[model samples]
Target: MTSFLEKWSARKSDKPKAGMRSAVDAFRVRVAEQKAYLAEFESDGAGFNKWRSTWFQRAPGGFGVTIGRDSIDAGQGLSYVVVETTAQVAEFLDDLAQHADNDVSFQKALEQNRLRRAALLNSAKAKVKAPAAKAATRKPATVKATETSQVSGEASVEKPKRGRKPKA
Candidate 1:
């Protein structure tokens, strides 16, 4: 029979990953025109901040975020990304650029941004070693006996009592 401890361990392992981090080069995209994610990052996916546009709720309140990593310091084409939590990723893909629909755009932007990151990661998997799934183990089943013979020469069994209506 499967032990409680084994079941507990399996459940624990099934919990969402906690150490994922992602990184990716930053790029600019118009929120109104962006069809994919501006960035992507799952704290425990492949690597932290790996995708130029993505979101991760590192802080409290589980507020999702879109990410933008840029080398704006050197101005060598200014590498950076913009992030929005919730479904507002696409709206905020590039902060510097102007978009009138900040509120809605922000929400949509966040979602699109996440999707973009996911696509990139999928592509990366095709090129690299996609992580392997953890294997789960099950214990052997136990046999269930239905009948027994008594030492006194009688079938030592009692029939279950019935006909009790539950009170409302």
Candidate 2:
């Protein structure tokens, strides 16, 4: 079979390390485990598209993430990573293992933040209600009268008595 890298992928500066091909299988192993975990949580797609996505950039044998067209509106974006050396790939595997733990921590943090926001909102609501509640609980104030309400038929009575004076 073709080597892990060939043609354009062959690094001009770093000759494909003597042992790279053999150790490259390790990349597959790490990728495999990631796929297995993804398999359990999968909700769509078939084959690798169903599980954790795997893409190869031949010139570099690098991998990275991109949002699949189908999931765009759902806001489910993709995360990509590539390992150029065996060390990087090893670190990637280790990171994958730690990712499980990280995922748990992330969830816990999200839940905590949600609870905190809820509590703050409740507190604000209580503060908003407090003044109105106190107003309701207190006795109503008596009205102080300054001006009297106008009666409907009240009219002026001082019409000039037209005593006709002597015609000028």
- Model number with the top lDDT: 2
lDDT of 2 by residue, 68-117 (tens): 21111111222345556434544554554454235654334434544676
Candidate 2 residue pairs that clash: 64-80, 65-80
User: In terms of TM-score, how similar is model 1 to the real structure?
Assistant: 0.22
Q: Which candidate's TM-score is highest?
A: 2
Going through the candidates in the order shown, the clash numbers are 46, 2
* Model 1 ranges off by over 4 Å: 1-67, 70-102, 130-168
For model 1, how does the per-residue alpha-carbon lDDT over 1-168 read when each residue is reduced to its tens digit? 889998787657555555332121122233322323323342343554433334334445433443333212212232333333534443444343332224344345445666776788899886665333221233223311222223322533454445689899
